[model samples]
Target: MIQRFLAPHRTVAAGMLGRLARRAAVCALAFGIAGAHAQETSSIVIKGKDGWLFPGWGSLTQVDVRGIDNTTRLIGQARDLLAARGIKLEVLLLPDKTLFYEDRLPDGQTLSPEVKARYGLILCKLGQAGISTFDDAAVLRQLKASGQEVFYRTDQHWTQASADATAEAMARMIGRDVAKLDGRPGTGMTLGPLFNERRYGDLAELFLTADEKKQVGREVYSVRRQAESSNLVDDAPAPVHVTGHSMVQPYFGFPQKLSSLIGRPVSVNWNPGNVGPWIVLLEYVESPAFRQQRPQVLVWQMFEPTFAQGPDASGLWDNASIMSANAWLDRLKTALSH
Candidate 1:
């Protein structure tokens, strides 16, 4: 009797069940596609504790200091390699922005107690290895505390003030008094800027979405030289050579300020940001310019986060062009022999 009663609706029941299953499959596929897209865009930017935005990779959450030992060894070996050729290698590690602005990090985000001390750790290691270095983090902090913006609010680069301070500190480390170096009083070299131009920062363009880019805005003040400027003059190859990423580029004023502070011209070679210091260093050493005019001092500037990262992390250098840290040290030794 039950079969007879239910048999009438069985066909309808089966069709309904089939439709439900198909709908569920469609929903699952849609969600899968959405999830993939979300993962891809999740790294664009992160919200900081105080409404500040930061690059996801540059966040303290992604930091891995376990590679510190390998990094230390690489620095020591590189120092030795350069020393054999009578060239002093000075390493300048720029601290990550997240370290100094921890108070602005996201609410749930927390730094390991040791994270704050990482800069000191690197300095200690470099010092033990007998490599010349400037206490960049300390200097930047002091500058910041004194009301000077050492770093841009929306960009990762150091401000001109910070660059000036570092240049002075570096000069002291090399035993070059800026006063004595600037022996020519009438040469017209001066740090006074003709004007300041406001422009969008790189991070404001890169990490922010189109809407966020328009809503959350930040600009950098670029100090430019005027047409009447006679302070800068053409000079021969400088005794001090600088190689690094965009931080040391001519446009950033790091090289120029450093030159003025050190009281001598300096040859700088760098590429677009994110090329990694390893490739930049290798290319500079192998360049015809370096062979023609070997510098007495080589200032190697790099960000602290990428110091331990292998060549693969750069994604800018081809495999054949880059090698492991140990292999790079060997190649450096051979290159300097000439």
Candidate 2:
């Protein structure tokens, strides 16, 4: 009797209808979002340069033609300007943290050497300009080989230890002895904005194991000197100046670390910008307050993507001071002589 009642129309008709409607809705969304993929040879067969399978969906967007063409001119101008200001400028293009973890590309596809070379060319061009750049990939690989980790696997920024290594490298790049750089002694009292505020926890969750976040922010950040000739005495003065991205700010104790290298408390102009990082960096260094610092060593930290975008096409902020960057360059030139 039950079979006869169910067999009147079909089995599980309502359940099947719900599933079909849901699938159709999802497909409609995919078609709406990635309409370009609608031109596939088959209803479900889409092909790419390497028989690339889209699996459930395809990326219909086209690659933009713009990339790193004018980095040289902009960097050359900034370097010349900074040099005139009597600063020793060093540029370090931090590698995309995703490049190493293989997060950007599809699974099972190894990052090709061509991709790496494309990444490396930015540094190569900087070298051609007679500007010193720290090779992040090389340094990261070396540190890993030495049983010392440089980056958190998931985060896009460096670990404090990595930041320390970077400070040392910057000192060497500026012809200053790395031994002079020192880590700030921890306050041994309380933590700073990082832990107290819980900023960057999402990104940190990717790179840090459970143990790494414990070391994120500190107060004193004291360090025992490793460089015999560079040890900090009881009352040494901080250094002239430091300028870079959020990476070099004192909260991570980068200023103190660099001061240890330079045998003083390193002043800094670190602004994390919504505009391009270089413009932000350039604007800060050229500012009157920052200008007064009179640093001999100027540390510039940017990522590979900055080289890709370059300065010619940079998004200028409404308040961007690049208009006067030229005059600042002239001032910097005079500083270089001092």
Stretches of candidate 1 off by over 4 Å are 1-44, 49-51, 59-66, 176-189, 192-194, 226-233, 312-322
On lDDT, the candidate that comes out on top is 1
lDDT of 2 at 76: 63
lDDT of 2 at 120: 60
lDDT of 2: 0.45
Model 1, position 207, has a per-residue lDDT of: 69
Across 198-256, the per-residue lDDT of candidate 2 in tens digits comes to 34333344344456445542222222223333323332222345555555555455555
| Candidate 1 residue-wise lDDT, 1-338, digit = tens | 01100000010145643553344334334323111110111254566653366655443433334344345556666766777777778787888777777777778776554445556665664655456787889888898899887766667677777777787777677664122432232332345464566765677777677776666565757664533443334444466778887776655566666555555556777765456677677777777677887877788887775565655453434444456666676666667777
Clashes of 2: 27
> What is the lDDT of every predicted structure here?
0.60, 0.45
Question: TM-scores across all candidates?
Answer: 0.77, 0.56
